[model samples]
Target: MNGLSGMREENERLEGEVSRLRTELSQAAAGDGGGEKVNELLGEREAIQAKVEAMLDALAEIDPEIAAAVAG
Candidate 1:
């Protein structure tokens, strides 16, 4: 029971972190940074998007019902 609770807490934390990272990536992606800076941020945005996707997949596995509710 304790482990289950811990897992839930960790899942929530990861979800929050993923959300924050996604926002940062979205902002960076939209920004007009010049040249190398733009390319670097775009790369970071791609990495963050991949990570966010993975986290969402994991969350879906954990609570598909919730994911479905949110999606619909």
Candidate 2:
């Protein structure tokens, strides 16, 4: 696939992962003795978020309008 398509797919996958992590984090917070798990999930979520931001930045460099729409 082309760079744009590849990036879009990666972005979607990362977004899915972030959503899943959010769910797990919620469950961990609600369950007993899950402090460690919650922290780990948070860390992972942050990393994925950073990656998403970076990808968006790259997209912006390539096409500002497309990037804006995608970011929305």
lDDT of 1 by residue, 1-72 (tens): 144465567657666766776676667667775455556656765775676566556666778785796477
> Evaluated with lDDT, which candidate comes out highest?
2
lDDT of each: 0.64, 0.88
What are the clash counts of all predictions, listed in order?
0, 0
Please identify model 2 stretches exceeding 4 Å from their true place: 67-72
> What TM-score, computed on C-alpha atoms, does each candidate reach?
0.51, 0.81
Q: Against the correct fold, how does model 1 do in TM-score?
A: 0.51
Candidate 2 on 9-60: residue-level lDDT in tens?
9988998998899899999999999999998998998899899888878888
